[model samples]
Target: MRTPVDDFQPGFAGRRSSVAGRNVTILFLSALTIMAGATISPALPAIEAYFADTPEAAILTRLVLTVPALFIAFCAPFAGLLADRYGRRKVAIVAILLYGVAGVSGVFADSLFTLLAGRALLGVAVAGVMTVATALVGDYFSGPARDRFMGQQAAFIGIGGIFFLTGGGLLAEFNWRAPFLVYAVAFALVPAILAFITDVHRPEALPKQEDRGLISGFFLTIPLAAVLLASVLNSLTFYLMPTQLPFHLKALGTNSPVLVGVAIGACTLASALFSFFYGHVRRRLDVSAVFALGFGFLAGGLALVAAAGSFAAILPASFLVGSGLGLIMPNLGSAAMAIAGEDNRGRVAGLLTASIFLGQFVSPLVSQPIAERTGYAAVFGLGAATLLMAALVALGLAGLRSRRQPA
Candidate 1:
């Protein structure tokens, strides 16, 4: 990978240093990343009961919430190629429109299958929205500025999650359909994205790598691969909160959607708080060090969740997990982009986005059977153990890298 020194040099062309409307638009779009799977989380049980007659309602109801991740995982790579070949703004605008349409389509869905179909379309839209918006971020910023904005982007997404989750909970109190209305907010952003977002020129072919004056594609692939692997593991565990927290709360005898939302929001709010300070955290730690801190907190937090006896006890545990995620999210993106060829930034961002969501889609698949056997609390315990292993691996790798480098 290239040093920070190489990243900031003039060879890499990007937007000006000053903040602009385009930055605001991309940040707003980032909020939708969590919304894809989480906004409907607070309503999962209600939907299941509402569709009690549907085949496999217990599982399919959850699929209505999670299926978007599957679609996004599959479609994001194509979305990236489109963003690269076509214009980023054009792709984003259409995606935003589809996001609103497909998201709200759930309000009229009469069966589990229909809802899953709508959510599937929503996934395709989100793939376009997320991939293009992220690629645009890389196109428009470099070095510390890119790092700062990515941190801000994650923070904003957390803030959005607080709003969406809490709002969905309160809305779910009335009807599961109400929360779907929140997706229509994307339509309002259409004008702003059109007005402010512009496409960066992408070359058809990359330099021969040697002339590029950066790490070879082969060497750069190593860290990118590592980052993608971490993305999958991080998301697999990170998602337990949103996907299982409602049921976990239900098990503890708290059934209010509003309370459920608030419980989930506690984690997101903490994530926002930590994410807002991620740039400061980055300055003090290397990428591997930051990842280690993240996984360590994640492990400890999940362990606490497994042992917590009541709702109040779970809040701080969730916050620790959130903080770990806040620290880890930006580092993964920044690390990948740090080594990516400028021409293929869109494709790379797409792959990263796909990996993250694929992990999310797979989480319930892996966790459900475990939860059935050991209960939700034990599910968290298992996740914590996995995260502990990840933390140890990261720490070991960082030590190895340190030893290989000059003092």
Candidate 2:
């Protein structure tokens, strides 16, 4: 079975030494996508208070954390299309520049609306960064190498989340705007991206009728739909930590932003640790079984969150949630990439990225009103129940697959 890497071997034959640098650069770029939303999560309450005079300040302030997701969801497919038509490196460079400018623009905004506008642009930038970066992983590697890189990529993003979330929390203690300064780090990565990242050359286009049929068929496949749906659900539930946990903690008598950061960082720390071992885990379990295991952890974690009485209790809960995410992240990427040919890898990656953020964007929208009416515990409880059901469905699918296989 010839892999994507085999096709490019001659071109890369002399560039073996550069592979490490390329992988590192792509991993660094992956961090930026998660940073788009999670970094400022601790500042939500402060932003809400600062904008008390604004209409619907409570909802809008939460949107400040999630609004970029909305834009990323809407714009990611377009970004992917551009990357597929043009080239990944050029799109990535431009996106990284936009990310820096848009990210920092929040620090200067005097109004909630302006801050959200900046966040929306940040989403557009994230769409480009995330889509191309994932596509590059598919372009550069195949088989076990791709699987290993996906795990490493997820682990790196989790590690980045710990730093940004903790740093943002501490900064929020000083001023809500302080966390926005973290966006400036995107600028530093531009030089590395230019030096190390190279775009893959796409094969010649198929005939128009055949191309359209193949692309349409791929999009409509059951496996692809399942992966996309699972990605959306996984993100929607995982996002509850950042969007709702701080307020939940405050309601439980923990009001410090630093503590809030630490609580959220616990989740990222656990995620990083578990993701570091994802390749080993994947070697033993099929993707459906992995999903079952991951969602089970999430179900257990959210249940703990709903029952917690103190801030300390949230740490263990966060760790459980992170473990689930650690597995699910790589599984989603690997599954989607497995189905993607080089011609549409960018579009597939873009769609998957969009689904993940779409869930993030929708998380607050779905959870907040429920929390407002039923309280935070009820919201977490309902999420736990939903995830539990998902876990069972995945287990059943795994069982069905096994039964169909020959002894």
Candidate 3:
């Protein structure tokens, strides 16, 4: 073996060596990040009821969520910088443990302010975990291998969402505290992380400080921008479907929580199935085509909901939308990373993660006010139009990308 004099710096982000153990560690981190999101959603109604002082006060609980999403959007790039600087393992450990501690504190929160504080803290931690984990994946794998694993991440996260939603739903029926306790899992995972994940960085992982800032101006290409915008739209569609759709159904005189859960759950399940076949589908279809199809599905699904008089109709419509969403994510991520290059992969992925959260933040806030002003259908119309715009942009990007490439 070469001596230490070989000056090998195959740290975590570096391509020094491949180890399955490291991958497992990364996947674990992803699970916690997803779980953080999963757990909060089901308990939203309970949270509102707990703070039933005013509609305005109740909205603060939502801030717990929207704040995290927004913060993740703002802070993801910075987190990546720290990960690449200090070391992936160290960064992940500290951030993850913080996420767990703050996240679990929600269970004991006695007031709205306390809960909000916990959620806000959790958001900062989530930014770190999400950006670093994705960056690590980029460093660890390339090409088909990376594609497959991201698909796996997509599918598995879908599965996790189901568990969180279903379990949180059930718990909300009993007491809201049930879901907040899910953060205990994060705390448990920390020891495993410390034991398994190595703090290595690849030599070519990210450019030096002098070069890093300059790359973003060039790397954030037109195609990549379209995908980021699409990511935001995708999140907008997701949030609109749940929060607004239920209100729409209520206007029709239906309030079956079970039915609502079933609709959203069906949509997520459909997305999971689409994620499973992401690779085969990607090989046969272009990325723009794949994303456009998803956008089409979302548009159709929303339009159907807009016209839906019966809850029975909402289920199939949601599935269609989910299929479209599921198809878009794996392709969007793969395409983004492909164009982003290794140097800015973490920051790019961070941007992607932020877009998703920001989209979620905007969806309900935007759609609800529209619904209140006009009607349920009006909100859906907005979602459909937004999705259609995204589809158009994706197609245009495809054309520009094709013309720019050389033979």
Name the top TM-score candidate: 2
> Could you give candidate 3's per-residue lDDT for residues 1-407 as a string of tens digits?
33111333445424434455556667777767667765666556557767888567545655655666777777777787666556667778888889978888888988888877788788888888887777766665567766777777677667776777677667666777877887877877677676656543543444565245523455677878878888887987767765666556666776554455566777778878888788778776678878877788888888787778788888888888888878887777787777765556666777777787778777667765677679888888778888888778767766776678796
Clashes of 2: 0
- For model 2 the local lDDT of residue 344 reads 78
> Of the candidates numbered 2 and 3, which has the greater TM-score value?
2
Model 2 lDDT, full chain set: 0.89
lDDT of 1 at 274: 83
Which is better, 1 or 3, measured by TM-score? 1
Candidate 2 C-alpha lDDT tens digits along 232-343: 9998988899999999999999999999999999999888888889999988889999999999999999999999999989999999999999999999999999988767
Best-first order by TM-score:
2, 1, 3
Q: C-alpha displacement of 19 in model 1, angstroms?
A: 3.9
TM-score of each: 0.92, 0.96, 0.86
Scored by lDDT, model 1 comes in at: 0.84
Local error of candidate 3 at residue 291 (angstroms): 1.5
Off by over 4 Å in 3: 1-21, 203-218, 249-259, 399-407
**Native-referenced Cα lDDT, model 3:** 0.72
